[model samples]
Target: MQYEFRPSGVCSSKIVLDVEGDIVRKVQFVGGCSGNSQGIGALVQGMKVDDVIGRLRGIRCGRRNTSCPDQLAQALLLYQSKNETKE
Candidate 1:
């Protein structure tokens, strides 16, 4: 499934993510540090969503309370809230 997440308290305006089960397939960030965003996108591919969240959540950008990575984690949580596992 795919999710579009809007970030707050960060430079990135939006994040687009594709995941199958808990593994991430693709990640795209809009309006952020281009190189870092691309790097993050590449690194998270094929990783478990929960694992990504654990690593990325609660990160701060300089003095602020949230970073792009943190926002991505929030996005994953939002995704979890909306998608129920199929038996």
Candidate 2:
């Protein structure tokens, strides 16, 4: 499955991730700290959704209390919940 997150309170315009079963295949962030986003994407590329959420959910951008990464985690959770309910 492919997931796209449009998060608030961050430099990135959008986040895109591709998942197969429990593993992430590709992650791309648009309009952020280019290098950092790329590195993050690469690092999380093969990780499971739960693992990614665990690692990223609490990350905050300074005092704003939510970063792009955190928002991505939320989005993934929401998406998973919605999909599961359809089954």
Candidate 3:
């Protein structure tokens, strides 16, 4: 499945994800710190969604409430919840 998410309290504007079952196939962040966002995307590829969530959730950017990674995790969680509702 493919998903797009808007991130709050961060430089990034959008997150795009491709996931298959429990694994992440791809992640892309729009309008953020290029290197960090790209690196985060690369690192999370092929990782289990839950693992990514566990690692990335609650991450803060500077003094802000959330970071790009955290937003990505939130996106995945939303994805999981939506999928769960389908079953």
Tell me the whole-model lDDT of each prediction, alpha carbons only. Answer: 0.94, 0.84, 0.93
Candidate 1 residue-wise lDDT, 34-67, digit = tens = 9999999999999999999999999999999999
Q: Cα lDDT for residue 78, model 1?
A: 89
In model 3, the runs with Cα more than 4 Å from the true position are: none
Clashing pairs in 3: none
Off by over 4 Å in 2: none
lDDT of 3 by residue, 41-61 (tens): 999999999999999999998
Candidate 2 positional error at 40, Å: 1.0
The local distance difference test score of model 3 is 0.93
The TM-score, computed over Cα atoms with residue i paired to residue i, of candidate 3 is 0.97
Model 2's alpha-carbon lDDT is: 0.84
Clashing pairs in 2: none
RMSD of each: 1.5, 1.2, 0.6
